[model samples]
Target: MHFLSTYQRIISRLLLVSSLIVTGAMADEVIMPPAVANTASNNVPTVGPSRPKNIIIMIGDGMGPAYTTAYRYYKDNPDTEEIEQTVFDRLLVGMASTYPASVSGYVTDSAASATALSTGVKSYNGAIAVDTEKRPLTTLMEKAKALGLSTGVAVTSQVNHATPAAFLAHNESRSNYIDIAEAYLTSDADVILGGGQQYFTPTLLEQFSAKGYQHISEFSELASVTTPKVLGLFADVQLPWAINDKQAHKLSHMTQKALDLLSQNEQGFVLLVEGSLIDWAGHSNDIATAMGEMDEFASAIEVVEQFVRQSKDTLMVVTADHNTGGLSVGAHDKYEWHPEVLHKVKASPDVIATRAIAEDNWQPLTATLLGFTPNEAQYSQLQSARMQGNEPLSIALRKLIDIQSNTGWTSGGHTAMDVQVFAEGPGARLFSGHQDNIDIAIKMFSLLPQSVQTP
Candidate 1:
């Protein structure tokens, strides 16, 4: 009898592991582990903690620890002996695991991670607030709207992108851009600011106008938006990178505008601000652009931090969905990494490469944009890459930058690494220490006026 009981227990454990490994379609057959199963009753507080009247959640897409560390060095004062601390350093409270549902393996995509962060539910890769079985999960933004609180999303990417889509809409796949864009018509977000003008049709614009939304396409027009409901699409797609942007601190500027509009509601508000292009720069392995994006994100954080300090009744949480590109400081067994080399770059590699390709005397143009002239070997490398096409030339330029700066990258994909969590103001203590990505949302749910029941 003892032997039989032991054998059965072993079988149960294996079956549980197997179930998690299976696709989302089969995940329903297995019970969740105790931690996730008992989360609502055990961790989600209802009455004890001080609930903030307002909440601000910021996501620095694909920013890992290395990215923060790199940013600190990138912005360091060479003349000063000690490295300058960045905004991320002052507010960091803890770390969070960014793994997706068992079906998608350990590493997570933006869609799944965003769903986890926004809805406090684990889902398969590419899912937009839908569970493994394609069931729509209620998001925190939806909850905020239901409670008659103000809600808004500000991002560098299109407002219909995965991160924002998870919070505002439910879809089977993030690639369904049109569906996601259409869903925003009823999202009830008061301040919608980002790119993707190509997705919003004339009919949709008319509908938005009928709904009392003031629409504008230029960044300057944001200053004249006095109405609480506004739609600002600054680019046809994702906004230009910070390095190439005409306006300095574009994300910070947008965040300030959103805050100005959302704060008008006396019932409180929930704002989601995403530094969306950090992930894109990481994916391209463009160190210069990545640093520029991080700078913009940091500036935005500073804006939110000041608001939190002033409001006192507000809580602000900042974190990343996942680490992209497996970024490392030093490569090829080098003892030193030089972030200062990147300080000279004035534009993204793609732009530099494209212009270089067009110019007959490409060396002068490349040197002007890069802030430094290429050596004989790098010149040969760029010439060889230029023979192929713009993309290859851009890749070659990035490689040259990597060599000069001693930057390292594992892959042009997401990594199963932990991301940092930074918080401030009321209810910030709850996010301190280590937790899962879903736990971040769960804690935020606890701070709401009402409890969030487990689904």
Candidate 2:
């Protein structure tokens, strides 16, 4: 264990050195795979070209470097020796530090990090778009709306979730669901998508409708929302896990639809698209569900990548608010992490456990959902957990998968780890190298017209 820790430290130092060199070398240009580089427009300059007309901020909630690295391994083709680069790998230009205000400690909740990313100001944990004093801070979305450019949010979680809420509203606490939901009523954002139908009442729905926003509850209803203004709530609180959900690329679909609507404005738009549930999965230490969410998020990034490439006047920045779960690729002093075992997982552990608890023929049901029969020891663990309750059974299932995959997690909460940042299109070069979370929002503010920027 001592030797392994030493080796890991050495590798981390080497990675840091390599990162510095790559960042310095690519400061003036967007570095992508040869295939992607060839297709990029020559007109897209790193700097000096006028600011991008459109800006797309994609936040993968709780996605740290570990998550991306794990995704690479999980998605790798075993048939080939060389690992394939994901959309994240291709666009990754730099990294960012995620720390909230000093009052809240180094680790940040989704709300504080999102506040910093949206308002260019550090705020205490649980703060929405408010600073430590609970005062309102002008968010990027508000600025875009004031500039007469379209603004919107599209996320897999409720629109009022911490990340999206910070961009759209000002509140002292992220838990103020009613207040945040009501704040959305007054926001001029053209597109609002996600869940949280429980927070909105009949009167609030009528108010949104009166404000010219087309409100819909079903995912299928997205097509009928042709107007620039639309409110989509797909679930009562948050969407289902991607592993068990029928809509495999829900985030990608929502992002595409958002772009379609926001692009109608001649002045361009500023859109916030969040893979919100990646955090939730991470909190549960659910690797199978985490990979599924990452895949959906990656697909969404590809959609935006294509849009930015085609438009040439747009900037797309992808990052995470903070790290969650302290996820490690390998666990239990094992040198190997088998991502193949996770690929066969048909449903989340919770769902599998719930069904197993309800069904009489539980063994086959569990095996089918897990895509593998448990060994004698694992079977005993499952049986023991089954007697306890659904939650324990779920934990046991996760443990079995972790034992097979060799995955490790240190916490069920946020960590003080830096997150990777991926960018492309005009003004993208500005984000190269390491930066504080607030710096990300400040840099984006520079991309906006000077007239509307706060002094």
Candidate 3:
């Protein structure tokens, strides 16, 4: 009897091992989407020359570690294996701390963090390319322009927004949109593409034209323009969220256009491209919107990756200003994440809020955005909040989605958490390991001609 039982146990162990192998194979069959898959095929090249001639800085605002992990899971819902590789996966060299000057508090805002990335100076929040004393500082783009190289800024938000503005304009306040626009007109930047038509009046457009800039409002016009200097304003304010944007130009298209224009300079160029809406989505704590924005940003990165492959002399550095919403994937009692639920979300919280106000209905808006009809009590609470005009529609929508999706957020504001930095091409090695955000600007400045280096 003992011999028979021992033999049976051995057979059971073998069967278990076979079953595990089959499950692993089944998991492997669940391939990643083409968008997030590794396209380079492990052909990432090493730095050929001493220093890169051109530098492209891409900022995905509020893209923290959690955001990347969530995006990977959302794109490829693996049951056993790790999430599929993204464009960033191949280039990730280090992480950076994003704290600003003491005057700005511990959690840095876009302006201060971008200032650190552009000028290598830590300034208070809302101060663009300025020191803590409000003194203007030279930026990487300025150095590029001074060296007779081209410069540009492209973004999914207003051209005068904090991130892009820090590279081109110096002001004590980021909210000075008109002043920022004026500064852009007088700057040496060759290409500027983004929203914020409201900030650029007929006078400013004439100024741009007088400066030999071809101002374009439509994507078709933007694509056809062969001018080295182009200004594209696609919307009145911030551009539409990716999930709701259908008519406007995509971020990837803007990035390609910027690259085409900047590459015209034989001496090389410095360009900043920002995925600004990712920050907005994080602030709203909307997972679906965040996923849409992240996907769009990744697509932009793919475009830049192709450029990096072809132009070996160009260096690309991608990082974030800070984290927002304190986003986490799992919830209490839930060991698994349901990124698939994000697909059912139809619109951003901004869209839902606008529609609710315009149509004077909350039930259908909630159902449409959250993919579930609210209970009678829940509907009444939303209706009451909307009627009172005290509770923000975004907060209400976020609360509802949180309850349904099991996603968690600590706050609606920024966090001091360190963000990832991915770099490739010449000088990419300098960005590896833990460092402060200002180190990026310092290293890029070191690579420029000595004559253009700030004292």
Pitting candidate 1 against candidate 3, the one with the higher TM-score is 1
What is the model-wide C-alpha lDDT for candidate 2? 0.86
- Tens digit of lDDT per residue, candidate 3, span 285-305? 888888889988899998998
Q: Which residue segments of model 2 deviate by more than 4 Å?
A: 1-49, 452-455
RMSD in Å for all candidates: 8.1, 8.6, 15.1
Superposed model 3: Cα runs more than 4 Å off:
1-49, 77-82, 246-249, 356-369, 375-377, 386-391, 451-455
Q: Which stretches of candidate 1 lie over 4 Å from their true place?
A: 1-48, 451-455
Q: TM-score for candidate 3, please give it.
A: 0.84
Q: For residues 264-376, write the lDDT of model 1, one tens digit per residue.
A: 98878899999999999999999999999999999999999999999988999999999999999999998899987898888899999999999999999999999888999
All candidates' lDDT scores? 0.86, 0.86, 0.79
Q: What is candidate 3's CA lDDT for residue 107?
A: 94
Q: TM-scores of all models?
A: 0.89, 0.89, 0.84
Q: For model 3, what is the C-alpha lDDT against the true structure?
A: 0.79
